[model samples]
Target: MALTLALAVNELGTNSVKYGALSNDVGTVEITWSLRPGAEGRGRELVWTWVERGGPPVSPPSRRGFGRFLIERVLAADFEGTVKLEYASAGLVCALVAPAPEDRAS
Candidate 1:
């Protein structure tokens, strides 16, 4: 799980450095996460969010790159989660929701 998250975040950071917020001095990226509780709080879900701001306008990539594939498929599969990418005109917002590993085995 750690490796998967590392790779996923690396992909996002790489993209930011290339064309997202980090491409410019005025831009910034905010990454946040929380655990959503389930019944008895025994089945919590991890929610990860990546938000870019003060950057050039955003648009869906013309193609689904390996990074996208990693987050959308690999990461999701590893954590049993779902990933959503929003390309609003303002910036890019990525949200990943997945079950906590320990909880998932229950």
Candidate 2:
């Protein structure tokens, strides 16, 4: 799970640097996450949001890239959750929902 998250983050960073918000001087990316109790008898669930702002006008991709595939498909399948990618005029936004690991014994 950690690896998956790391790879997802890396891809986002790379995309931002190459063509997204971080491509220019005035843009920014904000990433945040929260944990909530899972549904049914499951453990915790993680909700992560990635919001990019102040960049070039955003538009949905004509074709799906590998990075998008990883974030939207691979992670969703692996974590048994849902992923949403939004291309707003301001920037791109991604919301990832996944099952989180149980809290460790303390």
Candidate 3:
């Protein structure tokens, strides 16, 4: 799980450095995460958000790349979670939600 997250974040950072928000002087990337109790008193859920701002105009990718696959599919599968990628005019936003380890055990 740690490796998966590392690779995922690395890919995002790489993209930002090369083409996205972080590419420009004024652009920035913010990442936030939280752990909360699951619905109906289950274990816990992990929610993470990655937001980019002040970069070039955002648009959906014409093709899914390996980074996209890792972030959207592989991570989701690994955590039994859901991943959302949004291309706002201002920047790219990604949200990931997954069951915590204890929740999975339950």
Candidate 4:
């Protein structure tokens, strides 16, 4: 799930540069993630958002390239998460959220 979100963010960042506001010097890309307390203090949930500003307008890529498709598919299959697209005055944004099990790494 971590890898899924990371790659998804990475792909979106690259795509922002290629197709969104980040194409211009005035653009900015914001990538952020957080672990929030779940309902009633239960398991944590991970949320990530990527936002970019100042590039050309875009429609979703018509063809699903391997990286783009893979990121979406992985988020769905492994984490049951969804990718959301938002177009704003500044630029474009993608937000993702999923349940995350506790890390056992010592």
Candidate closest to the true structure, highest TM-score: 3
Ranking of predictions according to lDDT: 3, 1, 2, 4
Model 3 Cα lDDT, one tens digit per residue, 1-106: 8888889899988988887899999999999999998888878999988999999998898999999999999988888889998999998898989888777853
TM-score of each: 0.90, 0.85, 0.92, 0.71
39-97 per-residue lDDT for model 2 (tens digits): 78577888899999988988888998898899998877766788999999999898987
Which pairs clash in model 1? none
Predicted structure 3, TM vs. truth: 0.92
Clashing pairs for model 2 are none
Candidate 1 local lDDT, 1-106, one digit each (tens): 8999899899999998898898999999999999888556668888899999988888898998888899889988888778888997778898988877677863
Give the winner by lDDT: 2 or 3: 3
89 in model 3: Cα distance from truth in Å?
A: 1.2
lDDT of 4 by residue, 1-106 (tens): 6687667777777777777877788878878889887656657777777777667765666677876676667765677656666666567777776665563121
Supply the TM-score for candidate 1: 0.90
| Native-to-model Cα distance after best TM-score fit, residue 9 in candidate 3, in Å | 0.4
- Select the stronger candidate by lDDT from 2 and 4: 2
Cα RMSD (angstroms) for every candidate in the order listed: 2.0, 3.4, 1.4, 3.6
lDDT of each: 0.87, 0.85, 0.90, 0.70
Comparing 1 and 2 on TM-score, the stronger one: 1
Error of 4 at 80 (Å): 4.0
